[model samples]
Each structure stands twice: as C-alpha cells, then as structure tokens.
Target chain A: MQNEMVAMLLAGGKGTRLFALTKKVAKPAVYYGGKYRIIDFPLSNAAHSGITRVGVLTQYESVALNNYIGNGSHWGIDGNNSVAGILPPRQTDEGASWYQGTADAIYQNLDFLDNQNPEYVLILSGDHIYKMNYAKMLAYHKEHKADLTVAVLNVSLEEASRFGIMNVNDDYSIYEFEEKPKNPKSTLASMGIYIFTYKTLRDALVKDAKNPDSEHDFGKNIIPDLLAKKKRLFAYTFEGYWKDVGTIASLWEANMDLLDPSDPLRLYKDDDFRILSEDARDLPQFIGKNASVKKSIVNQGAIVLGDVSSSVIFKGAIIEEGATVKDSVIMPGAHVSSGAYINHCIVADNVFIDGSRRENEDGKEVILISK
Target chain B: MPHILGLANLHGAPKLGPITERRSIASTSFLGRYAFVDFTLSNFSNSGIDQMGILVEEKLRSLVRHIGNGVVYNANTKRGFCSIMYNEQYAPAPAYNNDINNLIENHWVLDQSNADYIIFAPCHLLYRMDYRDAIKYHIQKKASVTMIYMKCSDGKNSFINMDELKLDENGRVLEIQKNKGAKKNINVSLETYIISRSKLEEFLEFAKDTSHFFSIRDVLSYMTGQLFIHSYEYQGYLRAFTSVEDYYDFSLEFLNPKVLNELFVPEWPIYTRTNDTPPVRYGEEAKVSNSFVANGSIIEGSVKGSIIGRSVIIEKGAKIENCIVMSDAHIGANAKLKNCIIDRYAQVLHCNDLKGDPKKPLIVRERDIV
Candidate 1:
C-alpha cells in the first residue's frame, strides 16, 4: 500500500551551540544517551508512525549523517515500497545554493514531492530529541479539514514568549501566529513541526519564493502569510516529553532525562517509543573487578575499570584504573586516564583526559570538545 | 567471493532442554546477545563468501526470523544471496533429515553458483576463522576435500560428539572415528569443509548411488579410506557445544580474559540482528564486579562473576554470581541467584533463593516465572 504522506527532515543545521562536537559532524549526527544519534528519535518516530517515504534534506557537514542513514535499514525504512533518501543541495538550472530556510529547503525539493504525489507533507527538524507519532497529527489535520497543521505544545506563558505562539480559539482553530512575541496572549508554542496539504504547500512555496521582503522560512514568513490568507492552520496539541536539543544545556538535560527510571522520556522503558540507532558491532560493556558504577548508562565496547556515577558512556569509551566519572557524558572512544576525575562534563568523541580533576564551577556541564 | 553452502544439520542435539525446546541449536542465544548461527554467518560474511544456502531440516522459524533476507550480514546483495533450502519430502521423518538430502534438495544453489571452491560449514562449533587461507591450502594440496579441525580440550570432552580425524605425517586423513570421550587434547573435526564444487557434486553422486537414506557424514566416514582428505589444523580457540554441560562450560569460558579477547577480536567482527536497546544503566546501589553486561540491561543489585543479557532488570538487594541471565529475565529485589542459567524472560521472584552446582548449572525455562 502507498503512504498518504511524505516527510522532509531539515537536518542541515550547523549547531554552533554544540561547540567542539559540531566542528566536524552535523548536529543530527551528534550521539546522545550513549546509544543513539539525535536524528534517530525523529526517524524512529516516523517509522513507528508508518511514514514510508522520507527525504532527509542535508546541508553543512553531512558525511556522517549521510552514511548512517544511507539505506535507512536501521530504522526499517529501506523496504521495497518505502524509501529514505538523502536530499543534498545541488547546482541546477535554477542555480546552486544551500538550504536558505526551512521552507526553502522543501521548495528546492519540490521535484521529489511531485514524484511521490503525496496527499500531505510532514516537515521536521533534525536537532530535536523527541518521539512523536506524526500519523496522529496527520489524522488531526484531516479531521479539521485544514490546509496546514502545526504541532504545538502548551508551554509556560514566560517560555511561550520565546517561541512562536499560536493564538488558537477554544475549538483549536489557529487564528493568529506570532514569532517570539513580547506580549503573548497564548502559550501554545510551535514545535517547528508542520503538516501541509501537498497542493497548499506547493502553492505557498511557489508564491513565497517570488515575494519580496520574505525570509523563505516557515515560522518567519510562510506561516504568517497562511494566517493572513485565512487558511485553515490548525494547531495540534502534543502532550509528551519533547526537547529542541539545539544547545548544550538542553542536550545535557536530555541525556540526564534518560537517567531517571521513572522519567516519561526514559530512553529504554517505553515500548511505543523505540528509538532505533545504527549498530555498534562491538563487544558487551565490561566492568572490571575494581569498577564501581552507580546510576550510569554504559554502552558497548566500554571498559570501565574505575568509578562511574550518573553518566552516559558511549561505545569504546574507557575509564582507566582509578579514574572517576560523575555526571558526565563520555562520547565514543573518549578516555579518562588514571586518577582523572571528571564531573558534570561533556567529553566529545575520541577525547582524552588525564591526571586532573575537571569540574565546571559555572554549575553547568563543562563542554570539552575534542580537537 | 567463493561459493558457500550451509548445512543447517539437525545432527547436533538441540537438547539444552528447555532452552532448546523451541529453536534449533543454530538459533540458540549465546553469550547474552548473539545466536550460535551468528558466529558462522558472520565468519562467512566477513570472509567475503556471500553466496550461501541454509538447509533447514527442522525448527526453521526461529532461524528464518533471525536471518531475514540477510541484509544486515551484507549477504543479500545482487551479486550473492542467502537462500533457505527445505526438503519437503524428508523434513517430517527424523531418520531421513540428514545432510545428504539437504544438499540434494538445494543442489541448484551449488549448480548455479559461479565459483570453483565451496565452503560447507555447520553452526555447532563457535570460532572466528578466515577460510581464505584454508581455501588456499585446499587449492595447493589438490585434495578433493580439506577437512577443518581444531585441537580441542575441555574437562568435559566426553559430551562432545565430534569426529576425530586420524592423519598421517603429511596431514592426509588415514582414518575417521566418532569421538568416544577423549580426556585430553584431541583433534575434533569442526565440520567445516572446503572442496571444489565439481568434487562436491561427485561426492553427492557417489553417496546417491549407495542408498537414499545414507547420511552425508556416514558417506564421508565410509569414504575416509578411499578419498584424498587433507586436514586443515585450526590453532585458534574453539568450543563445540554438543550438550548442556558443554554449553555452560563454554559460556563460562568467556569469563576468562584471554579466551574472551581471542573470541571477540576487533579484526573479525561477529554481526547479529542489532537491537535498538539503549546502553545498560547501573543503579546507585548496584555493586558490579568483573562482569560482562550487554546493552539495554539495568543493574541495581550486586552482580559478581556473571554475564547479563539485554533489557534485564536486576532489582535492588538481589545478588547474582556466576550466572548467565538471558534477556528480559527479571531478578526481583533481594533474590539471590548463583550458578544458574536463567532463560529468556524468566523471573525469579522477590527474595527467592536459587543455587545450582558449579559444574551443572540449573536451567530456568523461558518465561518460567519462578
């Protein structure tokens, strides 16, 4: 059976907030919770939600992400009918340019959408670490008879001012949409996920491309224009744990969220949210006789000979004989030598720490980006 | 890549009792993560021998599910394929279900494959082997069959039902006899054979002319005095799991650092069906010492000298020592378990005490709920 909707994932963000981690890899390729890349959440969500076709739009440094999601067999999206394609920006008769905005990213790939001829198009960002059944949102879009549907969350009014607030009536009809408004009347914040009727999205993109004084962005330009035209743009209220992991604080907090056994966003607990990742293909985690691990998650290929407390250790990471790692994320192949004590830190991939106790006194995680 | 054929022989007893009650020996979960077939399949894939067939005589479902088109193994390419061969005429009758008919049923895989050498392997023995060198030796010797064997010695070699090869000084097989419990080091055939396809076809024809019910091993045993059999001595570590005791002993052997490193070398990787299970999480009170815990398990209590499988929950105050706890087997709070083989999804209730002999571990059946 053919799928009703196709998805376009915007994964080209440089994620400058990530400091050293993003120096080489794209934001979507960043490893999280010791087992998964950030993009696995959305891809798993889409797979579980039964979105058969996905066009992963990539820009920036995308080699890792490209190879990881190449055939998409990891997420079960590489079947005969289903396809997961990597859409990179290319030079054409129209000209060569990187993805300008979220809308422009889709606009450049209208040829792909035209080939699929889907009834609806789902738009997502690659930086968020959350599991959402987009099919349910698509159903809500169908029920409302809406041309566009934007996933919204009920955030606090204070936090809502920082997000794109949607002014929805009691019946859940979005009347006004404002990006980062000072005087916010509603707390329905946009999650940056949108579902649009294929025809409506095609017309909007074509119209927005020719317009002057436009950013070619969904939040800044296209969404407001849809509201001005009085189109049916319903706000789909999502009640679940979701995080835009675009910053170090949120990324660290997201990993910490998986530490709690009772956390709603528990990485391994829920059967519904199976966040699939690529295979590590390494041996099991080995805890040495002297190892004392408490309240931590350690991945495959990790050999822990020291003390670990409240940390997430990725594949091939090591804690030397007497080292102590607490409240830290040790990325893949990272090492902590003997007598090295690291607390509340994010050790980037392949990093080495030795002989010194390092702690960020700023009360935030010390970002140790590898060189 | 050389042509490869798989004999999913029901020859090995799938009698780990409750553990093997459902699946064949090939599909039995090993080392908390992989199946027995994964070792052989990974060896085949890593060796660049992609074209192969699995002759399923019995318990085909689990093996089929585990392999599924063989995409993860990189065996489902356009250049090669992993085919499941079944003999409908002989699968039901246990007496007729042998390697000879399996080859006869899937002879097309051998007939169509565009290769000169064929690596016929079984799943009972677990080891990492590069068959290229063995194939080179077979080519150089100009022998019809190059039999693979290792000098295997464990305390309980009596349970091992491998064929012992008697060789001359030139490494030519002089005689072959079924092992009758060798106490010390003995050459045990690993059931890995490399031969030319034409020679294999000739052997198949020779065995067919004798009897319809003649087994492949029976024919090979008879032909040992006639055929030019060269022996390929495998010097690496090998464990032939023929009985429950052998399974337990072999599993515990992985606890040794030297054996563990040798089995799981970085150069030759063992691939299996990858689960999206998150990394294993250790609780605040968890006191783990000298253990190998696979990903997706959450350990809380005291685990010493054990191997824990994926998605297991070891509750607080429970103590596990010298045990192999399979996936989803929950040990409740305050439960004490030692020298046990807890099967998949089995539960040892809160505060229960269970202990088995160090030599023969107690088997908790799958989803036993004890």
Candidate 2:
C-alpha cells in the first residue's frame, strides 16, 4: 500500500553542547521532561498526525537511541499496516560511509523510502520540544500544491541572524533563503521541518550527491539549490511551543516549562494530544515526611525526601533527606545525598552526589553533572 | 515446562464495603496504577505459567476492562492465553456462586490446557510468590496439595477471619480453621493452593456432591486430614484485604520504606496496564511528605502519609493526611481530610472537614460529588 506521507526523523546529531548527556547517547535519546526522551516529540507528533510509516536516521552514538525506538511500537507506528524502522548507515554493496549531512542521511535511505512509495516525504529533526500535528502542515502543502514546504517559526529580528532565515513573498512563498546572513531580510526562521514531493526531493538529492562542493545538508545545499532553480518553496507558519534544546540551559528550561500551568505545552491539560512513550513500569513516586516539593514535575519510581523547587525529577532518582534541589533537572537513577545542595544544574543519569554542594552562587550558569 | 495453569480465584474475596460495592475486589485499585488482580497475574507471568484463568464472581465489567487480553501481564498472544472464566449459570444465585462452580462451568479451560497442575491464588491476598518454587516443593513432598502460608506477627489484628493452618511436626496440615484473633503470632493461610489436576478434579466432584455453595477452600478445609496436605511457608510480604479497615491500613503501610521494599523487589516486577499520563506535577504551594504519588496528578495542597492515584487534583489549602485517594479524585480548596479512602473520581468539594479515626477510614463512594 502506498502511504500518503512518510516521516524521516534525523536523529544522528551528537549535540556536543549537551556534553556528557550525549557522550554515550545521541541527542535524540537525551532525557526530556521527567519521563520522555527528546526524540519522542517528533515521533509522537507523527503518530498523532496519522503518519504510520517512519524511518529514524541514526548515526553518532546511535546504539541507545536505536534501542529506544525499537520498531516504534510505543508510538503505535509499528506492526500491522505500519512501518517504523531505524535506518543506520550500513555497508552497502557500493561502499560504507557515515551520514555526511541531513540530506545525505535521507538520501542513503532512499531504498527504504522507495519500498513504501509515499506521495510526500516529511523531513523532521529530533531536536526541539513541541507538540505539532504534521498532518495539518501536509494539508497546507497540498492546498498550495508546492514542490517543497518548509515549516517556519517567527523569531525576533535581532536573533534572526543565528538561524537559517526564510525571505518569503506575501503569499508565504519563499523568494530568497539565507543561512545565518549578516543582514537579515525577514524574521521567519526555518524550524528544520520540511515536506517535499517525493520526485522533487529525490531529484534534488541525487543531483546534490554528485556535487563535490556541496555539503549535502538541507539548509546549506538543497534549499538554496532549489531556490536557484526557481522551484516552488513555501513557508508554513507554526505557532506553538517550539524550543531547540541544544544546550544545557535550554534543556533545563524546556523541562521547567512543563511545570508551568500556563505554558503553551501544558502536558497535564492536553489529554487528547497525549505524548506516548515506552512504559518504565516502575513503582509510584514517594515523597518522604520531611520533603517539600513545589513547582516540580516528578516521574514514577522517584523517591524524594528533601526540599525540591522548580525541577524535573526522573524515575528511580533519589533525593535524600536535607538535600536541596532548586531549578535543576535530575535524570533517571541519579541520587542527591543528604546535605547536598544542587541548583541550576543538570544531573546526569545515575550520577551520585554524596553530601556535596553544587550550586552556581550567582545562579548565572548551568552546571552539567556526570559520572 | 509442566503445563501448569493458574486460577485467580476471586470468589473467596471478602467485601471491602463501598469500594467493592460496584466492583469485585480483584479490580480494586491499589497503590496508584495497579489493580488487585495485577499481583496475581504478574505472579503467574513471573512464574512462567502462561495458561491462566481469572475466576471472577461479580462485577466483571470493571475486571474485564482492566485485564483485557492479559497482555500487560506478559501473557503471550500466540502460544499462551489468559482466559476470563465467569460463571453465568450461577450469576443470579449469589450463595451458590463459588470458585468451584466457576471452574466446573468453565471446564473448557481445564480440558483445553491439559494442565498437569492447577495453582489457585486469591486476588484479595497481595503478595509475590513464584509458583515454580511451590510446585517444586509440592513435588518434593509428594503431597496431593500444597498450601501457601505466612507466619504473621500481627495475626491478632491483621489477617482476621482468614484461614489459619495448624501444621504438625512433619509439616502436615492437621487442621484448617479461622483466626479468631486469639494469638499474636500464628500461621495464616494466604488462600493460595497448588493442587494436582487429578486431585483438583476429585475435589470438584466432591464439592458438587456435598453442596452447591461449597467453595474450593471449604472443600480443602474439610478434607485436610484425609488428604496428604503440605504447607509451604512464604517469608516475603503479604497483605489480606478482609475488611475496609484492612484495606486502608495495608495501603497506608506502603508509605514505610521497609514495608514497601519487601514486595516491590526490582527482580520481581509487578506489571499493570500502561496509561498515557504525564508525570506528576506539583504546584507552587504543594507540600508533600511520605506519600505515594502517581502520574498525571496536579497537587497544590499539602499531603502527608497518603497514596494519591493517577490524575488526581488537590487544590491549594487542601490538607490531606493518612489517606488513599484513588485515580481522578479531586480535593477542593481548604478541604481537610484525614484517614479516608476517597474512591476514584470522587470530589470533596463542599465537605470541608471530613475526618475519621485511624482504625476506621471514612469511605467516599466512587464518582461522588460530596
């Protein structure tokens, strides 16, 4: 059966800014909120958008991420008529090579895509924390009858230079594209999400792969080349909670956003649009007698016996008595012993702090604690 | 694998007041996310007993909704099966309905599995026991039936009205009688039995001939001395929900780490159906202590020594202590509650000060709007 649309999630980035969190795992597998991984956002969005076929492109530190996306059964995009496979760079008959760039990753998996023979291919990034239905974007793409569509988020003009800015016409048609230009013409920034007609994407990737000067990336090569050739490129404006949690501070902020009731991503209020993930099946979280938890998102299997404020506590993490955790993110199985004061920090998984104090006195910096 | 079959006997479960009024004890909510039958089914799954049957007596709709396909318990869909055997023949007759009758009515389960041994475990009793160990012990003893029991230190208070087995020097069951709270330390039956297929069939015939209302426990109690009965002593955690007080006490007792660790072992996982609930969120004023809080709960109040279930909402100024608030329950602002078993979806809006003694917890009916 030919699928209407297929999602190819780029989960290959190492995210050196995440430092120790991505040292042993890919950026997509980094822990988010209290019980979810960063990759769950796009995968769950695809599931909610009625996209059953998906291919996750993995590269650097891909073992843990590959294990987590096991056939995508947790996201309900596996088995039956659905297809969810992890596409890693393999030793093909031609040769063996690492994923050169975003576009190259998808290009290598063309055979996997051809099997489904989808009408349109949805390109996604494993970064960012948001809940969006790509089906609506696909509907917009169909109405415009465009050869390519890029999801753009409105950003302030001052921060526009940091992103790949899209200079579009009045009808949301892209007239010019700039990659971190010194002088910006528009505040519309690419969110690294795209929808392409299969033939158009395939032709562009095949041509780009032969060019020696090209970086084989979507933003650097394909989008610009498409514009140079006068192809139909439209921008779909997405007004939702979208945060690129590339750094330690942003990752901590994204977790803290979930605790705010008025936040755009109200995880507690959004019952219909649930973000499903694999069940940890741990025991319920226990708050000890002396514990005082306020403005926090705590997962099951966590044991809190101290004072916590404005934090995200993962499952199996422990906060011993007299320990103080303020404005921090505790990964799964991490422990904060008594007398340990943690503030403005991201404690890695299973990292134990034995009665030690780790706090930026001025609260100006976010510390990354790892084994 | 010696074709062993497990029967989650819910016929002998005692009434748990308003909580059990609309649902069977097997489907009763526990801790936060699990049902009482989850413990039994998980034990069967952990013991590698794939072929299992849940013998439900009444209020089977809720039970069926929780145990759909039994896949959560890791029951294989292809080779293994989890069957829900309900006795529709004696549905109208409450007195005549028993585990023995349910088994006889659903004889296809027995004929289909061709099981060599049948393990009967009650739902009301919460514990983790590997039936493989008991089966091995039963084979070693060469006994016709093996009864699982625990040496309870608080028998005078807990495990009341439950069967107490008097074992002889040779580990033979001399007598099976109810614990009348006469002693503090006593051997209490967990209502878990391992009987061979032939012996089970013989007992079923005897039960049918003696009385229509005779349960498997009653048949076993009568033929204790005549049959070669051996007792297997379980040293782990065990709790029997005989009454409302027992349920409240046992549920709150899990707040203690020492008691909680006994049954919640890492190696022996108790699986339940997964819900798509987010993590538990705490508001700015939330002050919790010594509580078991489940996922999707939004707490802005002060909770101490409580078990809050999934998606529960506790508003600001609401002070709850020593309570078992089930899933989707709401405690209104400034409402104070202590020693209460707030049922699922119950709203304590107008009730400001609902209090009860430690010995007795006030019951708020499920979905009640106070």
Candidate 3:
C-alpha cells in the first residue's frame, strides 16, 4: 500500500433541513457548539489523519466556500503534491447541469483523482462529527485486499431505516446493502464514509454515469450496481460519538451533549480524539468578584460579573451585574444587561440582550437578538 | 474656565457587549494574547500625563490582574501610574451610574498631585494615538477645551459635531458649530479632549454646590462661545466597539494584511499580557492554503483563506473556508462551514453544514450552538 491517499470531501449538499441557520450561509458554514462551524470537523480530521491531498466538491454557495478553502493553505494542503480545489458544476460532453447526485459529483471531478494517481480514494461526506484515523482504515482495506470498504456504525434498529443499511458476513464482507429500506436487514448502518481502490471507484463512477435510469447516488445507484458485478465490498465498524446534525433538534441535542462535564464528546481532552483548530490572539478570561459561576466552560478573554451556571461562555463576553445566565452558551463579546435572564439558549456572537429581559424560558426557541 | 479631566471609558465595551454587560470592565476578552485595554492605558502613559486614574464600572478582577501594579504601562510608581478609581458614595449605593460629574469628583480626589491639565479618555476604542500632539494644539491656541475630531461622511450620527472649524492662521480651531443640520459635513468627536484643570474643577464645584446633574457634553455646549472650545483632527484608525456589529466588523478587519500591518506595526506595538501556548501544529490531512493562523493551534481540516486563533481543532472531513474562528474552538468531523465567524470555545458537531454569505457572515458567538 502506498503512503499517499486522495480524500474527496463531498460538500455540495444544500443541507435544507438546517432551516434559518443555513438560510444565507451554506449548511457547512452554520455555527455549532460555542465557537465552531460544522465544516471544521471534517477538515481537521483530514489534517490529523495525514491525507494531505484533498478535493472538496462544492455547489450551492460555493463562492464563500471557495474563498474560505483557497488552496487549502491553512490545513497544510498546499504545494505540488497536494491538490485542494473546489469542484463546481462544469459544462462537459455529458451535458451542462449541476451535480445530479453524490456519485455524479465525484464523477465530474475524476480528473482531480487521475492527476494524483492515488492508490486509494477516501470518499467522505462533509457533514458528520467523529474522530478516526484514516491511515488505520486504509491499512484495514489493504489487508483485506477488498476492492471497496464502507465505514459502518451500529445505530439503533429503529433508526436504521433512515440510513443505508448493510449486512455483513462473518468475514466482514458486505453481503447486502439497502437504501432506506422499509425493513432494514441489520442494525449496521453505512456512515457514508467509503474507501475504494482508485481503479474500482473510477470504473464504478464511469458505469454509473452511463446509466440513464440511475439517480447517481452512492446508495441508490453505485452500491447496488457494484453488488451485481460481485465486486468485493467490506464493512469496517466505527465506534465513537458520531452524529449527523442535519435538523434543528439534532443540532441542539449535539450541543447539549457537550454541556455534560463528563460527556464522551470532549474536545478539550489531550487524547487521541482531540479537535484541532487555528490559533487566534485571545486573552485570558477574567472572573469578577461579583461573578458566581459553577460547572461551566469559560474560555479566555471572558469577563463575568453576573451569575453563570451550567453554561459555556466564550472569550470577551461581558455578563453585567444583576444578570443571571443558566444552561446557556454565550458567544464572544455578547452583552447580557442588568436583570436580563437567559436560560437554555445559544446566544450568537455580538448579540446584545438589553436591560431587564427574559428569554428562552420555553427552551425550544433559540433567541437571536442581533445588535 | 472649567477644568476638563479626560478619562477613557475603558470598561464600557466588551468584545461582544451582551456577554460583558453583567461583567466588570476589568475582565479579559478574546484577545488574551493581548490585553484589549492596554492600548488606552499605554496611550495615556506615553502621553506623560501625571495623576491619572482609571474609572472601572465592573469586572475589575481580570483587569487588575492584567494591569498588575501597572508595571507594564509604568502606572504603578509613587507618582500613581494607574489607579482603579470607582464611584465613591457618601452613602452606600445600589449601582454606579456613569455620570460625568461623578467621574469629575473622582478625578478631583485623585488630583492630590495637583496636575493642572486634565483629559478624559475611553478604553472601548482601538487606536494608537498621541494625546501630546492634541494637547500641544490646545495650548498653542490658548483654547479652554480642545476635542479630538475625526472626519465623518455623514455628520448626523455623532455625539458631537464640528461643522464649522474656526481656526487661526495656523489652522487652530477657534469655534465649533453646535447646532444639528448646521452643515452636511460631519467632524465627529473622538470622546477625548483637553480642558483647563481649574475650569473642570469649577464645573465640578458648581455641580456639587447645586446638587445638579451635569454632563461633559452639556458643559462643552454651554461654554462653547464663552470659552475657546475648538477641535483637533485624528488621522489614524479609531474604532469604538459600541455594538455587536462593530465588534465583528473590527475583528474581521484584522484579516486584511494591510490592516494587520498598520495596527501591529513595530513602531506602534499594541501591548497586552501574553499567554504562553505552544506553537500551532498542522497535520498531513490538513489542507491549509493562504490563511493566517496564530500560535497554539492544531489544524487537521481543510481550511482556506481563513483566520484562526489559538487552540482550535478542525476535525478530519470538516472543510472550513473563508472564515474567522477565534481561540479554543473545536470543529466536529466531516462538518462543512464556510464564510463565518466562530467565537472562542465553539464546537461544530459532526456532519453539520454551515455556509454564510460572502458579505454578511454568520457570526457564532462564544459558547454558542450552531
């Protein structure tokens, strides 16, 4: 097996379910937790996994996404050997149109994979939060001599129908795959993470492109077609805090999970799954004499004068005297005025809650009071 | 003549004002590697002004820590480099209001050194300006009060207006237009000015004697023609983060290399207490191209043309492009975020997709949910 592998990031989805949060920005650009966007996870994972050459397939709202991913310099994906570019829809001999499906998105950007001549192509979705070593997955794929490998995780049987369900033999070879079947064959669900030999992926993409009846999706089209050809496919089990925060409720729940002091999704721990990001010039947090805080994660540059409990306060936030904030996530420099009460809310950056206010009593409404 | 004591409102504006409302002004902010209040303190210190006192509304703990002994700005000596001056009540009070007269009285008590010249400066603004030059301009013209003014396109939004500049032959201001709509051109006040210490003392005495509420702006307006109230121009960048929008705008401006050079240039260093964090580390899957990341960060994502802060985590499969993420943020795996502002210690859950407009970015405040 070669040390070099090409990773294709599927970032073209519209992410319509994210609602108003993704109205202006792409779904990936939507903020999560206290101070991060959904896209940071996959990008950081790729960097940590040591797969330098990356290709991001972008479509909706690609302009901002392109500008953000300019040559992928921040992630150390630069130089002649590394290729990081936004592959938007282009007019070709096949026909001029936007990406019809996931397979099509990758098929159109085949040139990027060809130029790299990587032994393996790691195809992954741009949304999903988990930490795994792709190098280890690649080693698994090579050791099995499998033509293709899909990362599978055990989801609840009730929710298995929502994903691409896979049945594996004792040897770990995938025996069957069903897309959103009414009755899922097994609880094992494909996480939309796949590693395929360069040739196998290229052939599958080419065949799928020629099929007029195909929807061009991996589960809907390519995987079924590959199975008919008896192509070797294996399932690799992944155990971690993996989630698809596609809807508002799911996104909210994921954030709530971090509030647990002992939550398994700890990003601050210096362990194998530590989350990595860029460094900014942030100052140390200041807790005032009047400030009474407990069981909270307060970052640098935060000034707390009021009462904070079970909350996460970002840097440069000012909680004025007489204010009470509980079970909330306050962004940097957000001002909670005197007598303002915030409970179970995620306050956006620079949001100013005027004097003497009550918000988020219901817990379902995420208050966004822009200043 | 009224003596003017200029005090910078150092505690008024937090990075994100809402987060700091109940917090004291002494508290630190996202600029931990640099103290946000240091700019104003250094300006006053370098001006060689004696007997200066800092008026802190609240959040004094972190502020005191950063300005420990005032050693860095040389305000901790026998001469009183910098002192945390608050509103002293004849009787115990509920809360302190930022009244101009109360501030004036505080200055009077601290003026045991008997420094005749008084200036009031605010700490909420970002600028490396010289007060000595403005003071010189005030003295040369024998003006009773000289307010620092910056050119503004539309004059209606400013706290004070100087449409008419009555300057001497040497361009010294003699009079200022006070009435609104007097002229379309606006010369906004930078909220710092020089005043005769005795004149300010007189105003304070009058307010105290009558037990009347007096404001600095009201005094300036009342004695406009009687005293030689004039205006001085400031040429450099001066921004006050009075609102959340302002804070976001000013922070993003640092992404521009020109703005970074102008602000952090060696000739005028913006001093702040430093944090000792390890240098930024980049992994192989990390595809960072044409971006500026500070120290103490670990990049493992696909970041392009972005500005990231210390101790940030970009998980694999996550693609962050054209965004500004502050310190200690964690990006979940396979999430896609574009053209956004992520405040400190934020986490983007796995497989979340966020995209912001090119012009209007989606700003995620500290400790917030996406």
Name the best candidate (by TM-score): 2
> Which one wins by lDDT: 1 or 3?
1
* Candidate 1 lDDT by residue in tens digits, B1-370: 4455543344534466667877888888888788888888788888887776776767888888888877666645787777777777788887777777878877787777777887767787778888888888888999988999887675244425568888899999888777777557667887888878788788789878987777766777788888899999998877777777778878877877888988888888888888888889888899998888998888999998898988899999999999999888999999999999999899999438899998889889888888
The lDDT ranking, best first, is 2, 1, 3
Candidate 1 root-mean-square deviation in Å: 2.2
Task: Determine which window of 10 residues in candidate 1 chain A has minimal summed lDDT.
Answer: A357-366
Instruction: Tell me the lDDT of candidate 3.
Output: 0.68
Each model's fnat?
0.84, 0.91, 0.04
CAPRI level of candidate 3: incorrect
> After superposing the true interface residues, what Cα RMSD does each candidate give?
0.9, 0.7, 14.6
Instruction: Please tell me which predicted candidate would have the highest DockQ against the true structure.
Output: 2
What RMSD value applies to candidate 3? 19.9
The TM-score-based order of candidates, best leading, equals 2, 1, 3
Off-target runs (Cα >4 Å) in candidate 1 are: A356-365, B1-10, B152-161, B180-185
Per-residue lDDT of candidate 1, residues A335-358 (tens digit): 899988787788888888876755
How high is the lDDT of residue A57 in model 3?
89
| Pairs of colliding residues, candidate 1 | none
Superpose all Cα atoms of candidate 2 onto the true structure and report the RMSD in Å to 1 decimal: 1.9
TM-score of each: 0.95, 0.96, 0.53
Worst 10-residue lDDT window for candidate 2 chain A reads A356-365
